[model samples]
Target chain A: MAKQQVISPLPGTFYRKSAPDQPSYKEEGDQVAVGETIGLVEVMKSFHEIKSDFAGTVTKFLIDNEDAVMAGQALVEIDG
Target chain B: MAINVISPGLATSVQDLGRPGYYHLGIPISGGMDRYALRAANMLAGNDEAAAVLEAVFMGPELAFTQDATVAVTGADLPPKLDGEARESWTSFAVKAGQVLSFDYLKGGARAYIAVSGGIDVPLALGSRSTYTLGALGGLDGRNLLAGDVLPLGAGTAAAEGRSVPAKLRRLPGAQAELRAMPGLYWHRITEASGRRFFEDTWKVALEADRIGYRFRDGRPLEFVERTPPFGAGSDPSNIVDSCYPYGSIQVPGGTEPIVLHRDAVSGGGYFMVGTVISADMDFIGQLQPHTPTKFVSVDMAAALAARHDRQAMLNEIRAMLA
Candidate 1:
């Protein structure tokens, strides 16, 4: 099995979708590539785009939208 | 190789370069407090500068290496030893398998960095391996090192050769390290006397200091200009607008004392940020022990840039020498 790499660039609440009512950018088993925008992290009223650093399939979403996360918390896992 | 911990010293945790770009989401950059020393140790071990390292505070753990490994210790000198013999710092050395490493009480400074060849093998979380203890994230199970923990080393097995300890570690000059003042959102709201005292006086680190924040013992109480209604739901007049705050911001609340936030500080805060310690001087701040007298010096934007450039040049020179 290939190693799955998880990347989270910022410290904030991980939001899976653009808005509360929308679906997530990815689901389990979704194919994702490096530099692909995976989700948004909202910090202090500013929204930042979290991008995938590895080309792989999304194996898991470790955090739910609106969940508070510290710096370096894994938000998603990518099977590289 | 593996290292077993006998006594997990005070507040020991795994750290790297820290997590950035998440302030807007209310996550502060949590990483090694003394970043320069950490980087130097990593470089000595021929590891990536951001590789995971053990951050030991005050006292350190008694570690037993399971295999031969190259290691470097940096930052605060806690009287570390290998197999009961004194160990040198800021230079890499070979540790025989099964040799015991331990640290005594800190004589100077607050924390130390232990970097193994390659790096510590903690799974990278949020692009870093630093532990944010308050949030319960990163490091080994998102907490301080405990007894019986075994940390794995990274894949590389290259041993360090010709260890050379420098006579003195470079530091930011105290005269040039007056804290810098940017006009924060609520900077103008304080009284003129309070503002003057903020620049003129030296503060003492209170016993309440920790990774979360360093509270200072200022002489006089700080009074707000006026109390206004809550800005938003759950917002109070004491709260300032949430914005990006760099490391070393000295935030003053309703109390007289100021709190100097460190690596594990929260992303955004509501208190008044009176001044920010320049990045060049931050490492020095990390070396401060409890009750240490800290004088906040003011640095203008131009001076801050010059200091940064000067430090970068020093780093480049060190790299060149190593090459």
Candidate 2:
């Protein structure tokens, strides 16, 4: 098995949930498919989905929920 | 030839200088946040200076060309990629029919303007090709570019490849930006101490920043002068009788977060504006990233005019060089 990381495409605040009241898109150990949204990066009031490219089990989250992220920053680790 | 949208990048929209003269009708002047960059890209692509270009924010749209064309990317260092190979920003390049154009990660700044030869051929609305998405008025159906959409191009001359703008002529923000502002109108509504602190304290660009306005945070709350609320105004100290909001006007809602209205801001609002960021500094605000430290430098009317003049001179220099 190999582990890969999902990277944020833009810089801004990262959110695990779509909204404050919603459940997180993914959690550790959750199975994810290619193109599955794992989180969102909000830039200048707009939220863009961070989709995983590898189908795998979520191994670890590299960035914390609601933390600031830079473009190309690794966000989550997945084991396939 | 047309551009086929492969993947519409985040907030990619058609924009020009903007649609003015209709703000009184509640129509905002929606266009590129950084006007200079838009014009520069258009000129480099051999289009009219005010021709519409695609404005991509943070990320660049994946586009496939239906014909060979010359193109230029300006503003922000979101390096343009022609079929996976990197191309220079602020320089004109050629893209062949069936070639895909994309962008690498944003290296600096915010929005990038992509100018293709002949410009975007979306029919003009309200005398401009700029998109006013809020009003659904101008641009291609008055919205952002979407996947699978085909954008037509106007007739244009072929601009020479490798036409590069000198590095010195390019505009990029420094470590910190000082936005010069002219305090007036409702400046007296806040306590003198609050007014002083507004100029003294450093503020961070808030996540709430967007096309409508830019919000700043981490600054001290403004203390307003005790006064009775005016008719139709809310009870909050930051509220005032509804008034016209000028572009670049700074309004502190609840006397806490200061929001500077930008190109697409509402025509009227109830908030009291403490001051307006001078025209010369408004472009700098557009390039500021979230969490960037900024200071509002207070300037008098004469200084503001002088800065405006200097900006015009700089534009003239660019025009002459390109001409």
Error of model 1, residue B188, in angstroms: 0.5
Q: How many residue pairs clash in each candidate?
A: 8, 0
For model 2 the local lDDT of residue B317 reads 78
The residue pairs found clashing in candidate 1 are A11-B22, A42-B25, A43-B24, A43-B25, A44-B24, B178-B297, B178-B298, B179-B297
True contacts kept of each: 0.00, 0.69
lDDT of model 2, residue B309: 96
* Candidate 2: RMSD to truth: 1.7
Restricting to chain A, the TM-score for each candidate equals: 0.88, 0.97
**Residue range B1-323, candidate 2, lDDT tens digits:** 79999999888999999989999989888888999899899888888899999989878999999998999999988999999999999999998999999999888888899999999999989899998888887888988899999999999887999887898878877667789999997999999999999999999888888889999999999999999888899799999999999999999999889999998999997999999999988877778778778899999999999999988887787788777
Best by DockQ: 2
Model 1 stretches astray by more than 4 angstroms = A1-80, B172-183, B227-238, B241-244
Q: How big is the positional error of residue B218 in model 1, measured in Å on the Cα after superposition?
A: 3.2
